[model samples]
Target: MHLLLVGPPGAGKGTQAKRLAKKYSIPHVATGDIFREAIKNETPLGKKAKEYIDQGKLVPDEVTVGMVEERLSRDDCQKGIILDGFPRSVDQANALSDILQDLELALDAVVNIDVGDEEVINRLSGRRVCSECGASFHVEFNPPQDAGVCDECGGELYQRDDDNPETIKERLVVYSEQTSPLIEYYQERDLLLVIDGETTPEQVFERIEKELDALE
Candidate 1:
């Protein structure tokens, strides 16, 4: 199905997006992946995106929309796609609707994984990544065998700068301001599937599956 996954930063949208894409046998069209591929291939739009990214500026909505349109127009996406991390605002959502109209595709659902700010802070702040091999661990949910060390590679584990509680709260504030309206935008169109995300990843995916099954 043509799907969009939306949630706050730590709400497990990426995890569920992968599961849904694999289950449905559709492309998982993530915005970050698109930008990386385009820039690696040195496409015109990719070059434009790189210029802005190199300067630490947000790429313009026009460039982002163009990239999404190009991706959705590809042969592989003719079946359907699971979109992640685009349409962060109502304006972008409108642009996406127009793009899909031109491509003669409609979104089957916009899945909103709902997790509270405190839960998000707890989930993200406790995360640790292996400096050597990039293995992920959580202090509470999945702690390493030894503190501050990787079990797989015996590398030092470090927390990302942005994974601190203060940074996470700030991000949640920004997400609330920007995405609350976008959530309503999809809800008004009757294409929203709100799922509780304050559970284990497996449980969250099960909830999402049930919602998608109801849609079918």
Candidate 2:
């Protein structure tokens, strides 16, 4: 079940990763989560990543690669792991190859959740997060019980600045520019699985499971 998920921000990579990892009994490895855990735990790499993350910039590939290298070396990853928010560039992709080589491991597949810019805008624009409970609400699909209020908690809901249109477009640009090469890299290895993301999350997850089952 070892796999990688590559998608733009707000493309629901986290949602899909959660579903797939649970179904397959694989650890979901997200770089952002790892950075936070490392920083909170005061690890050396976490300290280095914090400096970059605080500035709204990416951690350098060397530091990020080292962190992921250490993560993959853990015993829990021996059976399989699901990667999210990683290998954002060709260099990182190559670095991943080296790391997996060192571990004598091979990725089963790389799943790409492809969504259009307009769809992403509509999806993210409607999203609101609870300031207190941290619950997510989508105005269209899953609105809260009260407008501008969290259902689970009586907290005001707010949109993150990064969910704004301009920031989302900029992130899309970065994702395309950086991740396109990794897509080609995996395509060349015959390990790329492209899935349309406009469908419902369950539909998309079914597609992913089917793809992985085929690989098995």
Candidate 3:
């Protein structure tokens, strides 16, 4: 099933995407991961993306579309792919539609894990990470055994600047401005699945599983 998962920063869409990909034997393709790999390897597309990244500018759609086109054509995607982050704007969504239409691949669904503004703020603001091992913990959900410390690596957990309330609020604003239309676009096509995102991560994944099962 070719799928798209859309949600706010703290929506846990990534975790659910991973689980759904594993269950359905599809590649979980995240734009950030793709960019990191491309930029680290310095591919032609990566070079283009890096010019924007180095200048603190967003990578243009042409460059991103090219890289994604290359990725989706791979043999593994014969099954399908779960897209985590891409098509932030309606223009990109149209571009994706063009690509998929040309490839003759149908999108199964577009899922939105919907959590409200205050809940999103609280969830993200309380997030902390282990810098050394990249382990994520929340003050509320899964606190480390030692307060502000990682039990496995003995590393101090620190809140990321991006997780700050002000920054996260700005991100949500940008997301709403850029992605709301895309959400509506898919909704009109009768492909949007809205899931309550305030639930536990396990429950969220279970909900995604049920949605995908119904689609099948």
Candidate 4:
């Protein structure tokens, strides 16, 4: 069940990926997690990535591809992996195809969690996070019992700049420009599963499970 989860920023694809990984006994491989682990352990490629990070520049695709290649080569990934936040463009998707061919592994499905623009804006703009405990909440969907406070840790809840409406719109524009073609690229291959993301997380996961089950 080698899988790729794709969605807009507030689409909750990450949550579904985690659940799918746990349920299927696969590693949940996120690009950010891979970079951090590599950098923290000071691998050769990680060192190269760090140099770019120190300069506040995006890590080169070659470096990123190398790291992903290394990760997929690991024993745990031999079973399969749930990939999140990689292959943002057609070029990267092609690189991923190459990497998989080298490893002799094929992707089973690419799940696209589809949420509308206004829905995404509402979901992200209403999001709040605990300052101390890092707990998450939403004003409309999952509000804290006490206003502006964490229910679990008594921490003050704050909105991240990235969650602002303007920032979210900008991100969606960037994502549209970069990822739309990637979606088409996969769709043409008949490996895409499009699921509505405006529903509850449980419902969304259920839909994803159904799709994966169909693949089996």
Candidate 5:
């Protein structure tokens, strides 16, 4: 179940990645989580990444790829791993290929969740988070018990800056520019599996599992 999960913003890749990893008994290696852990621990690489991240710029490939390579070498990754939020560009995809070769492993699939830009904007624009507990809620899908309040912790719930309609539109544009070609790159290798992302999470996972089963 060595896989690379790709999707645009608000496509629910994070949720599906966790479910898929559990079903396959593999670690879900999300780069965003890794970056947060590193930044919290203040590792040398984390410090370098923070400089760019705080400035709203992409972290250098050397730092991002180095972190991924180090994570892949860990014990839990020996069996298999589900990669999320990585290889955001063709260069990183190529770097990943080289890294896997060095580790004597091969990727099984590159699963891409396809969703419309308008749906993405609608999904993200309605998203809110708890100020204290960081719990997520969506206006249309999972609204809180009380408006502007966290259901779990009684904290204030507010939309994140990045979840605004304008920000989401900009993010989708950036994602399309950077990730569209990566789709073709994987398709050329016969490893791309594109699935509809607008459906329920369970339905999306079923589609992904069906494809992965075929691969096996």
Candidate 6:
């Protein structure tokens, strides 16, 4: 079940990634997680990544690709792995193809969860987080007992700066620009599986499972 999960921000991609990984008994190889691990362990590639991250710059493709290659080369990845958050651009996609070729493995599918820009804006902008416990809530979907307060810890609930409507809109624009061609790239290879993301999480996972089952 070697899969690449793709979605815009607030599309529930992370949730689906965990579900698929658990169902298939494969490691969920999220790039962010791997980067943190590498940096924590002070690996060479991690050090390079940290330098760029500390400077508030994107990690160069080579460093990102190197970290990904290292991760996929692990023994646990022998059977399969679910990849999330790598290959954000077509260039990285090509790099990934090369990495897979070297490893003698190929992606079974690239699952893309699709949601409209307005829905994404609504989903992200409405989110609030607990300042103390980092608990999450949505203004509409999962509000706390009291307005702007955390139910569990009695902490103040605040919307993150990045979760502001204007910032979310800007993020959507960037996501579209970066991901459109990457989506097309996978579609050309007949490995793209587009799933409706506006539905409930279970419903969305059902659709994704149906698609992957067909592939099997």
Best by TM-score: 5
Go through the candidates in order and give the C-alpha RMSD of each one to the true structure.
1.7, 1.3, 1.4, 1.6, 1.2, 1.9
**lDDT of each candidate versus the true structure:** 0.92, 0.90, 0.90, 0.95, 0.92, 0.93
Residue 78 lDDT (model 2):
86
Predicted structure 1, TM vs. truth: 0.92
Expressed as tens digits, the lDDT of each residue in 47-126 for candidate 6 is 99999999999899999999999999999998998998988999999999999999999999999999988999999999
The residue-by-residue lDDT of candidate 5 on 12-131, one tens digit each, is 988899898889899999998889988999988889999999999989999999889988999899889999988999999999999999999999999999999999999999999999
Deviation (Å) of 105 in candidate 5? 1.2
lDDT of 3: 0.90
Would you list the clashing residue pairs of candidate 2?
none
TM-score of each: 0.92, 0.95, 0.95, 0.93, 0.95, 0.92
Q: What clash pairs does model 1 have? A: none
User: Compared with the true structure, what per-residue lDDT tens digits does model 4 show for residues 164-191?
Assistant: 9999999999999998788899999999
Error of 2 at 181 (Å): 1.8
The ten-residue window of minimal lDDT in model 5 covers 37-46
Clashes of 2: 0
Q: Which candidate is the best by lDDT?
A: 4
Clashing pairs in 3: none
lDDT of prediction 1: 0.92
What would the C-alpha RMSD of candidate 3 be, to one decimal place? 1.4
Q: How far out, in Å, is residue 63 in model 3?
A: 1.4
As for lDDT, the candidate ahead, 2 or 6, is 6
Q: Report the lDDT tens digits of candidate 2 across residue range 1-216.
A: 789998767778999999988998889999988887889998999999999989989688999999999999999998999999888899989899999999999899999898999999889988999999889999998899899999998999999998988888898898788887888899999999999988999999999889889887
Deviating ranges (above 4 Å) for candidate 6: 130-135, 145-157
